[model samples]
Target: MRSLLVAVCLVLALHCGEAAVSCNTVAEDLYPCVSYVAQGGYVPATCCTGIRALNTQAQTAVDRQSVCRCIKSAIGGLSLTPNNINNALSLPAKCGVNLPYRISPSTNCDSIN
Candidate 1:
């Protein structure tokens, strides 16, 4: 029984979803696909799809800036390095936080910081 359970767990882990990556994971994982696109300096179909997913997912989040920052930091570390993607991205130009996108700290998040 123990061996059967272990085998089943291994199979499940190995055969997980092969579908396109989601933004949440991308945000969490720095959207490795986007990093690949950014590194390539060209937005391919996969990157566009991921971008759309990112925008849609951002709409669902209450704190969008933090998420963007998380994604930015992740993508910045990628070989392509984060550049211009933020400017062209669907993320707001400014948020309460003083994100890398903005020049100064936002008055909106002054209290939180």
Candidate 2:
């Protein structure tokens, strides 16, 4: 719950060029879809598709608290840091999205942007 909120808040804030996008939405939205994958269950393509939609809106993200919250809710027990931030941002991009990274938190994602 906290993770989801954090991720959303970050993405929402970044839309104005302050935040950076995290792939929490991709993980959150996809993790529950094929619970029985090991049992031979199949995940719908749309799950990733939806993640892509969300990513489109977050290209200029801010890396806010909400994104961290969303990541917490999505990853369960993982930690947050600048290292994995790129990976988290890359998830939805695999599905076909811009998903750019910003240079600084003080800046609106990109220094020039």
Candidate 3:
């Protein structure tokens, strides 16, 4: 019985690890862009790199919604000004990513699909 329990636990761990990336992962990926988005200036190449990676990673509807929620939450925590929000919204175009939905704190993630 102990061996069976151990096997079950191992399987569950593996399954959880294989699950889709979390909102925190998305937030981490976008963390580097905060400065650029917060200030009015040329966005660094590294910022674009992270944005593109986020676009590619969030391909599915669920993933997109997760990303949206993460972006909203992450930006809210940043204490950026209104201009920062505008600059952040322009990232997709600047980075050449065609995001399916707007990146805003008020966005409804459930309506992404």
lDDT per residue for candidate 1 within 1-113, as digits (tens), equals 24423332343333322224333444433232433333344444554554455445544333344444434343333333244344334233221122333311222322222
Give the per-residue Cα lDDT of candidate 1 at 76: 39
Ranking by lDDT: 3, 2, 1
Off by over 4 Å in 1: 1-24, 27-42, 60-63, 76-113
Highest-scoring model, TM-score = 3
- Tell me, what's the RMSD of every candidate? 12.6, 8.8, 11.6
| Model 2 CA lDDT for position 14 | 38
Residue lDDT tens for model 3, 1-113: 24423332343233321216565466556656756665658887877887888778877888887777666655544455688778888888998988888867667877986
Q: Tell me the lDDT of model 1 at 81.
A: 20
Report the alpha-carbon TM-score of model 1 versus the true structure.
0.37
If scored against the real structure, what TM-score would every candidate get?
0.37, 0.34, 0.75
**Per-model lDDT:** 0.36, 0.41, 0.66
Per-prediction count of colliding residue pairs?
Answer: 2, 18, 0
- Tens digits of per-residue lDDT, candidate 2, 82-101, equal 53444444444445545343
